[model samples]
Target: MFSKILIANRGEIACRVIRTARKLGVRTVAVYSDADAHALHVEMADEAVHIGPSPVGESYLRGDKIIAAALATGAEAIHPGYGFLSENPDFVDQVVAAGLTFIGPSATSIRAMGLKDAAKRLMEKAGVPVVPGYHGEAQEIVLLASKAREIGYPVLIKARAGGGGKGMRKVEHPDDFSEALSGARREAKAAFGDDRVLVEKYVDKPRHIEVQVFGDNFGNAVHLYERDCSAQRRHQKVIEEAPAPGMTPELRKAMTDAAVKAAKAISYSGAGTIEFIVDASQGLKPDRFWFMEMNTRLQVEHPVTEMVTGTDLVEWQLRVASGEKLPKTQAEITLSGHAFEARIYAEDAAKGFLPATGTLYHLKFPDTVPEGATMRVETGVRAGDAISPYYDPMIAKLVVHAKDRPLALQALVAALRQTEVAGSTVNAAFLAALAADPDFSKGDVDTGLIGRHQQALTEIAPPNADIVAAAALAASGAGALPPSNDPWSSLAGYQHFHPAARRTRLHYGEHDITAKVSVRPDGRFAVTLDEPYGSTNAHDLRAAPRLARWPGHVTVFSGAVGYTFAVPDPLARADESAASSGSLRAPMPGLVKLVRVTPGETVTKGQPLLILEAMKMEHTIAAPHDGVIAEIATEGAQVTDGTVLVRFAEDVHA
Candidate 1:
């Protein structure tokens, strides 16, 4: 094995690679940008180097800088951990030219699968079943539209380069094909610098199943079963599981054999994933699955495969890169228990899954169970770390394993419920709700599952009475009250002569909760809540509730969700009012990609007003109601969250 290696990435994947390298007694070097100077992965590495500025283009994407850092640190090899430079064939060639081992597939293998259209043609030559689509080289808009017409309506426009649901769109009709193509090309250009796209027939009830394949220089390859990545949002995988819930042995064997065949055909070395789109409207079948694309690096959900197969894919990568033979033959590998991995992201599900940035004040994962011994958390962040907008907003990947699919799923739900994350907007509640979803629990999953159940999953239910009480206890001085010799000072709301009540007010979104708390004569506390579900309650002053406070915010983990209440200062609340101004504010901090309205242009409700690109996704801000634009922000402007993007006439209501 190599003595030292450089992790050419950031976030959890970097940390993940570091862990496996350290176990092999290999020293690891971490590269970071300005935004991640104090990042968790940097602190965990044996040595760290500052590459460039915060923006990924200036740092992570700078292959020259990364190569220099690796050479300077005397790293024998470089591990491109999934995202930035993982699939860059040019980068792989550069690493090889620098005389450093690239801990992944060769440049030829990467190139074979770099462009979707070309990869499809390549797969077809290798006798691998590929989706029926327009894989031709023509990029003209009219040609693409005609191809969509030939395929049928509801065709998918996918970027020729890059993966992870970027630069992809689904058009439901011929009329929408032009607009979808334009959007797809623009996103493709912005994301992958390749505006070319391929039009493919959209599969009905598609289920994403990918086979994990590994190879060595000795021309040996094997498959590690498969992962069902059907539960998705916005075409991105959300929750993934190993040994697909309803996958039969025959289907699994067929898919794995095909995946291995693809790997051997390219003389693929190291770890790679062969993703297939399965037509599951009927059920899993050998002939119903078709090749989607090949990811030429370690996957984000590799842990699920590791849990079920008892294999460390990173370890396999290191061994193979070191010129070792395949760890195990196809017949030697065996599947064990089932596993699930839920990606926890720092996003607000209530606000359309908008990416959020904040310090993680309180972070906790579920305790490991005896039967779920393989349960683990893969993360590169801690409680004090900030989720920066310069990178992916993923918080962590929660993985669990059990004897069967049902047990594994149950454990996953329990773990998601027990997880606590504060000091930022998270999708914890949404994940918990999804875990308990009746349809999900039954394994009736597909790409459209989340979109179909979006309302229930994103609903922000009001806090119950217990949550209010917990917020009241934390907001009041009771929890932090110091011990005093004087009886009046010892108790909260104590009086010298007459009884008095201390009022505590807290804000949860738009609602205000006021609690009238007073110390009874016997030293017990009497609490009364105002408005809505008004009720009188009693509590002992000796116990403190489980709560976390960060400046103006207090969070209480009630039920499966953590409720955060904003503690507005009484002095500041006086100046606040519900100002019904005719303004449309930016929902999140992002770059104004396009401004569609002018000073006097009239727009109807739901009309395209502007577009803001943030967290690697484009959000189109629509007209709230019929209005005449009086002012508008400029295109290409960087705006903060809540910044007014458009101002309308006084007569218009937003």
Candidate 2:
């Protein structure tokens, strides 16, 4: 095995690689941008090197800088962990030219599967079943529209060059094809620098099942079963599981065999995934599955595979890159138990899953579970780390395993309930709702599951009296006071004849609540909350509430949902101008990619006015109502959160 290797990535994947390298007694080097200088991965590596500024164009994407850092640190090889340069064929060639081992598939193999249209053609020639669509080289709009009509309605336009749900769109009819194509091409060009796309027949009821395959220098390969990533939104996998539910032995054999065949067809080396889009309108069958695409590196969902198969894929990558043969034949790798992985992202599910950026003042995960189950949290951020707009807003990947699928799912739900976070909006509650969903628990899932039930899933219930009382106590510091011998020290609520009530003001969501507290001799609090409906609710607590109080905020976790309250400053003035202004502000810090309207242009409600690109996704700023644009931010401008992007004419009526 190589003595030392450099991880050419950041975030949890980098930290994940470093852990495995350390286990195998291989020292690891980490490369970081200015944004990740104090990141968890950097602190875990044996040596660290600063590459460039925070922007990816200047740092993580600079192949020369990464290569130089690896060479300077004397790393024998480089591991591109799943993103950035992982699937870039040119970067692979550059690494080889630098005389350093690239710990992944050969450049030829990557090129064979880099472009979707070309990859589909290659698969067809290799006798691998492919989805019926237009894989031709023609890029004319009229021709593409004709092909969509030929393939039938509801076709999917996918970028040939990238993955992760970027540059992808589903058109339901010919009338919407042109607009969807424009959006897809623009996003594709911005994401992959390739606007070319391919039209494919959209499976009505699809289940994304991908097989994990590995190959070695000696021309041997094996498949590690499969993962069902059907729980998704906008074609992005939300929760993934191994040993797909209702998968028969015959179906498994057929899928795994085809996966191994695809890997060996290109003389593939190291770790790769063959993703298949399964048509589950019927059920799991050998003929109903077709090749979607192949990920040419280690996957983000590899941990679930590891839990079921009892193998370390990273260790396999290192050994194979060192010219070793396949670790085990197909029979030696046996599936044991069931596993599930839930991706926790720093996003607000209620607000259309918008990405959130802030400091994580409180972050906690379940460290202990039941005896028969195991819980693992793969994260790169700590309690005090900041989630910036420069990178993916993924907080962590929470994985759980048990003896059976039902128990494993139970453990997953429990783990999510036990997890807590603060200082930013998160999707933990949404994940919990999905995991505990009736159809999901019964394994009746498809790519459209989340979409079909999004409104119900994203709806957050109002906090009960206990929760509000907890926040009020935290805000007032009434439950956290030190014991005093003198009764006068706690006389705030005391009266000559009877106990008096002291009121504390606190802010929750959008309303300011006044909480009345009366202390008891037993150290309990009689709390009364003034409800919004001109009524009062009271609760007498038995003990101190479970919560975390920061300088200006307090977070209370109730099951899987966390409620954060702002402890307003007593002497600070209130500013509500932004809330009442007729302006559209950027929701997150990002680059202004396009200004769709000029000043004084009229737009209708929900019309696209501008595009803000952040965290590798484009968000279109839309008109809130019929109005005339008075002013607009310039295109190609870097903007922070809440920066005004478009202002409406005050004289114009909606």
Candidate 3:
């Protein structure tokens, strides 16, 4: 095996590669940008080199800098762990030219599958099933729309150049094809510098099932079964599993064989994934599956695959890159159990799943998560680490495995509930909802699972009455309401005139809850409420009511959550309008990359007029619609909380 290798990536993927390299006794080098100087991956690697500034354009995307760092560190091979420069053929060629091995597919192979149109054509020739659509080099708007009409409505326009759901659009009608095509092309150019797109048949009920394929230099390749990545949001994968939900033995064999064929046809070596979109409306048949694309490096959800196969794919990548054959034969690799992986991202699930960034005050997974039972956590960031907006917002990946699909899902749900992350909004509750969903539990998996019940899935976890009462008691900082005469003392629960009941309001999003506390004789107050989720009563008026506190501290509540109200000399007050709406805000900290309109431009409802790039993905902020843009508040600025993007016209004025 090669003595050393360089991981041409950062964050979790870099750490993932280093782990396997360490297990194989191979030294690993990590390259990082300025923003990730103290990142977890940098601290874990044997060696780390600072490549450039924080922005990807200046650092991670700079092939020359990465190559130089690899050579300086004396790495014998380079592993492009997805993203950045992974699929860029020039980087692979340059690494090979520098007398170092590229631990992935050959540059020629990548070039063949780099473009969507070209890859589809190649797959068709390789005897792999392909989606029926236009792959011709026609860029005219009229022609493309006509072609969409010819192919029937609901054709997909996808950027021929990039993945990650960027530069992809689904047109549902002949009328909207032209506008959607232009937008897809624009995004494609911005993301991959390739405006070319491939139009394909949009499967109504598509299940994304991809096979894990491994190969050696001797043209020998084997498939490691398949992963069902049907649960998705905004074209990005959120949850994935191995063996699929409704897989037959015959269908599994056929899919695996086709994946192996695609890999061998290109003389593919090392680790790669051949993704297929299956038309489940007709039930999974050998003919119903179509080639989607090939990921040329290790996938993010690879741990679940590892759990089922009892093999380490990264170790295989190193072994194959070092001129050794794959450790397992086609028959030797077998799926033993079902596995699942939920991608835990630092994002607001309720608010369109926009990537969020914050200091992780505490981040911990469940210790009860089974070891041999298949629950695993693969993450790089730890407690106290600040989640930066310069890259992906994924904080960790929670993987679970079981003897059967039902058991695996049960394990997954328990793990998600036990997993707790403080100081930022996460998708934990949403993932839990998915794990416990009856439809999901049953084999009704598809890419549309998220969209089908988006509201219910992303719904915020309402504060339980017990928890709310606990927060109130913690906020008061006393076991009971201190007597007004001796308010500074800790023991007073009730005083003169029926215990001086006070009213405090809580505001969560657009909803409001009012709690009226009547200090009781037993140091516990009865709290009655008119809450958005309905009224309830909560108790426990002790100094520290319930043990929900973290670290060495307990939180007295504040605002809607309860701010600890210490029994000091005096207190403050609030008004009726304090619960009303403030200005429309940015919601999170990020860079305002583009402003699509000026202050006076009139726009229709849902018209996107601003773009923000945060958490490694671009987000377009739109006008709510049918109004004039007044007080447009952003333009390529680094904004923080409450940075208004645009205001409504005069009618919206309060």
TM-scores of all candidate predictions against the true structure: 0.96, 0.96, 0.87
lDDT of 1: 0.87
Among all windows of 10 consecutive residues in model 3, the one with the lowest summed lDDT is 558-567
Can you write out model 1's per-residue Cα lDDT over 129-200, one digit (the tens) per residue? Answer: 999899899888889999999998889999999988888999999899888887788788888989899989
Residue ranges of candidate 3 with Cα displaced over 4 Å: 370-372, 476-507, 511-583, 589-597, 602-608, 611-620, 625-627, 633-641, 649-654
Clashes of each: 0, 0, 12
The count of residue-pair clashes in candidate 3 stands at 12
Query: lDDT of each prediction vs. the true structure?
Result: 0.87, 0.89, 0.78
Error of 3 at 535 (Å): 11
Q: What lDDT is obtained when candidate 3 is compared to the true structure? A: 0.78
| Model 2 clash number | 0
Candidate 3 residue-wise lDDT, 384-448, digit = tens: 88887777889899888889888888788888877767666688888888877778989898888
lDDT agreement of model 2 with the native: 0.89
Q: After TM-score superposition, what is the CA distance of residue 482 in candidate 1 from its true location, in Å?
A: 8.6
- How accurate locally is residue 68 in candidate 1, as Cα lDDT from 0 to 100? 98
Give a tens-digit lDDT track for model 2, residues 1-654: 999999999999999999999999999999999999999999999999999999888999999999999999999999999889999999999999999999999999999999999998998888889999999999999999999999998999999998988899999999999989988898899888999999999999999999999999998999999999999876778899998998988878888888999999999999999999999998888889999999999999999999999999999999999999988898899999999999999998987788999998889999876668998899999999999899989999999999999999999999998888888889999999999999999999999999999999988888777788878766876656544444344435568755566677888888888887666555455667787523232234444455778778888888898888888888887775445367888888988988899998989999999988887777889999998888899999999988978888973233
- Scored by lDDT, the top model is 2
TM-score of 2: 0.96
